[model samples]
Target: MTTFGSQSDVIAFLSEPSAYGVSDLVKRIDTHAAIIFLAGDRAYKLKRAVRYPYLDFSSAEKRRLVCKAELALNRRTAPDLYLEVCSIGRLDDGSLALGQGSPVDWLIVMRRFAAKDLLDAMAREGRLEPKLLRELADGISRFHELAEIETHHDAVGRVRSVIEGNRVSMAKLPGMPLAACDRARLFTSSLVLLDQLTPLLARRGEAGLVRHCHGDLHLGNICMWQGKPVLFDCLEFDAGLATSDLLYDLAFLLMDLWQRGLRDEASLVFNRYCDRRAETDGLAAMPLFLSMRAAVRAHVEARGSDLQPDVKGRKDKLVTARRYLASAVGFLDRPEPRLLAVGGLSGSGKSTLAARLAPRIGTAPGVRLLRTDMLRKRLAGVDPEAHLPESAYTRETHDAVYAALLEEARKTLDAGWPVIVDAVFDFPATRAQVEALARAVAVPFSGLWLDAPRDLLHARVGTRRGDASDAGPAVVDKQLERDVGFLGDWQCVDARGDAQQTLEHAIAALGSECPIG
Candidate 1:
């Protein structure tokens, strides 16, 4: 054993594979606050001996505590990834050894997975399938449900702090690309919006909606582990940062996907999570949540430019930072509210079209997709894939579902957010009711009736798996027998072909009526 007494010695010891009893090849990755060393099947994360305004790891004791905290917090979502916190200690022979003697440094040991399995890498490689995204959304929703609710903090105050922090940080940045006027406008708009939502935020907090969540929920922090999406590397330094409205936590991933130009994927995750959680009421606050998330990323990226070693790297970071700022501003620039109803048979692609059109339709994070299947499942207190008995689809139950959908749409439109209803309006009364609901609210309404061949509809329903809609081939057959009387002025979308073609046709038919795209 070699004698060591300094930080450089500890680093040198860890840099060698012999220290880990593994291959000679050691991979090192550095972040602003931590250094990760990957050796063979295990990875060790050591916090940098640095202090920032938001975090401090300057002391060995503090680093050890944070390492333990990180293990505990991240284990909530990724128990398999975070193994344990190990101490790098001075052995009896005076050499630094992992898990051997008196502590000199701390590291969080983890089970290393392939880097290509990261959601960000999958997305970049175009391997991020819709099924995987749906699974990820469900995983996040479940995590939020089980997260501890924070009762001590004021939700509004937390958001206000973030808004103020972004402003102050940007102001302090030297040669920031964002204009002062632009920053002022965003700050003012955010404050105004916060003022309007204060009561709602308080009510949600009181209702236990504010939870200790995964603060940094971007795609990069998620990865495929054991054939499932596992969330790891959660914010652990600041409890205040991690404790927030669940939707606000969700907005980080949404903003990341939107910035990556994956609008459809972003919309799917949003709608899927909303469906699983039944969180339509919070849609009004999403724009602010998304803007705040973007702003946080902006200033963080801008600050990152200062940490870069070269001019080119700094310039690239600055450009990314500016784009994030622009995205933050763009999130607040909402369009006029409108109501879109996509009605057809069970497998006529109503839900598919609604999901596809949602991201293009309204404000930043897209319109509220109110699907009847999800509503029925929620009302029945069953999982979306849980089969519903025949009694569950009675006429009375059907009326109740439609009424709930209409009421939700009304509230969404009142909040100045667009909505898309996905349901089977086989009856003239139901179709008329939907049209009247939009008219009563005095918002532009577009009714799209998707028509497809019977065989395709039956086949589509037959192959359904893990879908909210429990409708089968028998249900499609029953729908085919129903007489759907004249859908006056409703745009008939021929959804007999592939999904993309059907979406294009529907968008073209709606044209200026649907000003979303």
Candidate 2:
């Protein structure tokens, strides 16, 4: 239906690789989208020049809508990368110049990023770092804080329209498995609960949680920009698709992480986001979203093989989509969690474990981590790294801060969310309080008391920097002398040697999302 390489000028530039050493510059397409090379620095995206029930990529106004949606969403974390949408023109001499006439076509120009820095490659080479995931978690939380929420659309109206459309697509597929039908139905029921949560969903939009978001987030769309994570290639063709739950938006990337088989890294990313956000109220939003993403993938595959007669060739992708849909259904079945808590003496890698173990649990998008030091500082109206006198650690301050942490945990868990509570819980009273709360809430809880040779702790603490926990080498002696009360509810994990090695052992104990007996 379309002719690529027909434009000789464009073809020549692509075929003759430039200085950045780009080679694979042909073209790629899905049912609704297509991408073409415009030099190594940018790519031009054009809608399939078709209209559908869910998306109208036909008229000029429709094309403009997509362009605006993509530009706004991508500006969230990668403003510098996505330049603009320019008008394409057919000149009098019959040539195409960007931004030239009455706009014969529309395109999104984005700065190109390297492929090898992707999480998939990083996972394959075993080069993913907890610190990087931690930073990425922080970055995403910041983006959510600034996003615009959906005000006009009810949760059911917004969500079901997309889900049900996928059901239609699944039905149209060559031979969708029976399991997929079951999964779509489960996802449908979950949307029923979502309808009840519409008011809250709208409140979140009012609170600015829903903004135009990078609609198609995956490892390939994210890159390390100046040692920071930058998201690009946002959904440019559909505002309705882009305006949805923050968790739903995040699920796409999380799904990509799992698909890449970086389960540990996925868990770390999940927990890290949760820790920073503590948006436990959004927990119920996960199933609805995760299912929708899986549905999207299902429809995507069905659409990909729409006219390709090789029915056998598409079976593998169909099966993959079917499994993902079932997984979405499984989350709706409410699998009970085995809560694994990461705790330790100051600077003993407890935070690291919490960050890494989260994405490994469910197909959940991101993790939530609760840091005592940061919470304590916030309670006292001070910056995380601000000097806290010994008075700040008094009995009254400790009680209030811990109470807040416990309350946060309740809120986080009640929302069906996972979190890493970063605290010493050194005193038996503190440890016991956490255990009792978890039992009262009926949430699975695990306590890991992280430790190191006292000398190692001393050395690490002596040189710690840029963190809020005020416990230094000077405080280590006081901590050591203090009664490390009640060791009953916790397991002691050695936090010695290199930090990464310590994390490897902890991840093994946590097991993969699909735990084997």
| C-alpha TM-score for every candidate | 0.94, 0.79
Off by more than 4 A, model 1? 1-6, 92-94, 174-181, 306-309
lDDT values for all models? 0.88, 0.66
What is the C-alpha lDDT profile of model 2 across 162-249, one tens digit per residue?
7777666666654555365585576567777667667666666666566666678777666787787776677766677777777778
CA displacement after TM-score superposition, residue 195 of candidate 1 (Å): 1.9
Model 1, 348-426: lDDT tens per residue?
9989899989989876677889999989998899877788988899989999999998887888788778889999998
Q: After TM-score superposition, what is the CA distance of residue 356 in candidate 1 from its true location, in Å?
A: 1.1
User: lDDT score, residue 233, model 2?
Assistant: 72
Name the top TM-score candidate. 1
Task: Show where candidate 2 strays beyond 4 Å.
Answer: 1-32, 59-61, 117-127, 174-180, 183-185, 188-208, 305-316, 337-343, 347-349, 352-369, 377-395, 417-420, 443-452, 462-470, 486-517
